[model samples]
Target: MSPEPTVEQLIAAARAGATGDDELALLDAVIAVTKDLSSHADEAVDQVVRQVRAAGHSWTVIGERLGVSRQAARQRYADRVERIREAAATGSVIHGRDLESSLSSALAAARADGLAEAGTEHLLLGLLTDGVAAATLEQLGATRDKIREASHRLFEHPTDWPGGGVPVFSAEAEAALAAARQLANERTPDCAPIIVNTPQLLAVIATNPGSRARRVLNHLGVDVADIKRLLHCYINVPRTPFGRRSRRGRGGKKQRDRCSFCGHPRSEERRLVAGPDVWICAECVALCAEMLAQPADGGV
Candidate 1:
C-alpha cells in the first residue's frame, strides 16, 4: 500500500485548493488543515493507547515502545485514560453506530411531523429500525406506523411553530438517552465494553414515566413493563470468572494445567479432569452434571 500524505503534502494540497490571490485566506486554509491533521493524529494515538492499555500493557512498556520516559508517557495519556474511565463509569459512551442510525431516524421522524424538536416518542419510533429493540417491539405489536400515529395523537404540537431548522432533541429525549447509557453501562459485564444499543434506548424510553414515548405506548395499548421484560431476553450480561487468570504459565509460557472450558489454572482446591485433548475443572464438571441432570422439558 502507498504511504499516507505527509503534513507538507496536505498543506500544499490545501494551498492549491485556494481560490483567488488571498494570502490570508491561503494561510487560514493551511492552518485549518494543520489543525485538523493534528486533532486526527491525537485521536488516533489516544485510541491506540487505549487498546494497548486494554491489552494489559504498562506505562513503562508503552513508554519504551514510544521512545519516551515512563513518567512522560503516563503524564501524557493518563488524563485521557482517566477521562475515558470516568465516562464509562457514568455511562457516557453512547456513540454506537446502531444508536446513531436510530437517532438519525428519530430526527427524521420529528421532521416528518414538522415538529420543532425530536421528542422521546420519536426516539421510540426510531428504535423500530432494527436490532433487539425492533424485534421486541414487533413482538409487542408496536409497529412504526402505530407508534407514529399514537405519538401524533398523544403529544402536544405547537400551532405556530416552524420546523424548517434541524430538529434538536427535547429535554425528555436527552434524559432518555442518558438513562439508556446508564442502563447499558450497568448491565454490561466488567470484562466487556459498555454500548448503548437500540434495546437499551428503547427500554429507557418505554419505562420513563410521564415521557412522550411511554405515553405513546400507553395510547397504543402496549404495556411499558412488557418492553422492559422482553428486552431482558435479548440482553446477556456474562459474569466475571472466579479466580480467572492468564492461560500462560510462569515467564509467559503456556500452561498445560489450564482448564479447556474456562481457561482457568488448575489449583489444589479445583482439580481438572483430563480427556484426550480437553481438560475440565471441577466447577465445569459440576456445572455439566447439573445441566445433564435437567429433564428434556427444561425441568418444567
Candidate 2:
C-alpha cells in the first residue's frame, strides 16, 4: 500500500479534480441551469411563503430572511398568501353564466351521485356539460354521457351524504380552483384580473392527470396525455395573427403553413377553416365548436 495519505495531500487531490478553468466552466454551466431551476420553482417559493406565514412569521421577519424590506415582502407575497389562505378570495372571482351553470351542475352532479362534497370529479362532470369545456373534453374522448357515467362508478356512494345544506367543495376541488386561477393568469398576462371561464378551467383540469377528475376521465378511456398536448397548444402556446406560433409576416400578412389557432399543419387539419384573414385548423375547431353549439340552444 502507498504511504498513509496526509490530510493536506488528500485536500490537494480533491481540489485538483474540481479546480481550474475546466471546472470553472462546469460551475458556470451549473449556475446557468440553477437559474433555470429557480425560475421554474416559482410555485415552490409560493408554497414556502404560505408555510412561513402559517407559522406566524411577520413580514419583517420573512423579509429579513428573504433579504428584502418588510414592505417588499408584503407587496410581493402577502396578497398571494392571503388568497391561498382564504377560500372566498378565489370563490369571489366573478364567473360568467356558463361558469354559474357549471358550478350549479357540479353541485347537482354530487347530489345525484350521493357524494358528500363536490370533489374535482363532480366539477369535471360539470365541465363536461358546459359549452366550450364540453367541446374541449370531447376532443379527449370524454363525452358528457361517458364522463357522467364514469363519475358514478369511480367511488361507492355513502347513503348519508345528507340532503339539506349546499354541497361544499372538497379541499382538492378548492386547490384545483386556485390552480385554475393561476393557470389563467399565466396564459393571459395582457388580460388583467382574469376571471376564469369554463374552457379555462377545463384546460387546467385536463392536464392535471393526478386529480380525481382525471381518474374518472381515465375510466372513460379518455386519452389524458393527448388532452394535455392539445390543451398545451390551445392555452399555452402563443398564437400568431394567423393562428400559428411559427408563422411569420410578409407584407404584414401571414406566410406560415400552420393553423393560426393551433400550430398543426394543413395535413393534421383537413378542413382548413378560414375567416377574413386568419385560419383555424380542424383539430382546434373541436375546442371552439361550442362557440357554434351553445348559441343554438345557447347551451348545446
Candidate 3:
C-alpha cells in the first residue's frame, strides 16, 4: 500500500482543492492536518522521554538534552509519565511499541477534535493506527476514514477547552486499557511482565458492549463477537515444547511445530493435537468442526 500523505502533502492538496466559496473548509482541513502533525510530534517526544526515563536517566539529564531546566521538563511531562508508570506498575504491564503508537494516534484524534478527554471512540481510532488491530479491522471492512466519519456523526463533540492542554483518557478509555493489560497478563507466564499489544487493546475495546468504540464498530457493520473470536484465534497460537526459551530441537537442530491447516505456532492458550507428520491447533480444530456442522446446502 502507498504511504499516507504527509501533513505538507495534505495541506497542498487542501489548498489546491480550495475554491473561493470554500475557503473556510480549506482552512479547516489545514487546521486538522496541522493538529495531526503536532500530535505526532508530541507522541514522539513522549515515547523518547519514556525510553530515556526507562534507561535510568534523570529528569535533569532529560532537561539538558531538551535545552530546558529540569523543573520545566518535570512540570511538562511528569504527570503524563507518572500516570503511565502507575498504570503499568500495578499489573506489571508493559506497553508494546504498537500499543504506544496506537494510543498516541488515539490521543491525537481526540486532540484534533479539541476534546478534553480521549474516550472509547478515540481508542477505537487508535487501534486503527497500525498493527494487527488495523489489519483485522481492514479485513472486516472498517477503514480509518469510515470510522472517523461514523464516529463524528454518532458521537458528540464538546466545545474546545480554554487551555490547549493534552487531553486525558476518559474513564472508559482507561478501563479498556486496563482490561487489555489484564488480558495480556493472563496469557503470560508467571513473573514475566505482560506486554499489551494492539490486538489485545482492540479486543478489549471491541468486546465492551457499552463502550462508544464498540458502538461505532457496530455502526460500521463490524461484528464485535466476530472480532473477539478472530483476535482470540490469532492470539491463542499453540505453544511449542521449546516455549520461546530453546531454539534447539533434538540433537541441537532447530524445530518448530505449527498448525498444518492455519500455520500458527504453538502458544499457551491453544494446544496442538498431533497427527502423522502434521499438527492442528485447537482453534483450527474447532473451526473445522464448526464448518462441518453446517448443512450441505448452507455453505461455510
Clashes of 2: 4
Record all residue pairs in model 1 with backbone atoms less than 3 Å apart, i.e. clashing: none
> Residue 52's C-alpha lDDT in candidate 3?
59
lDDT of 2 by residue, 57-113 (tens): 687876765668999989998886565445333434535345568878998888777
Task: For candidate 3, write residues 140-190 as lDDT tens digits.
Answer: 888889888999999887675565889889999999998987777665434
**Candidate 1 structure quality by residue, lDDT tens digits, 58-174:** 898777756689999899998876665666566456355556777999999888888878999899888876555776788889899899878777767666656579898999899
Off by over 4 Å in 3: 1-91, 159-163, 237-300
Pairs that clash in candidate 3:
237-267, 238-266, 238-267, 239-266, 239-267
- The top-ranked prediction according to TM-score is 3
Report how far residue 111 has shifted in candidate 2, in Å. Answer: 2.0
Q: Which ten residues in a row have the lowest lDDT in candidate 2?
A: 1-10
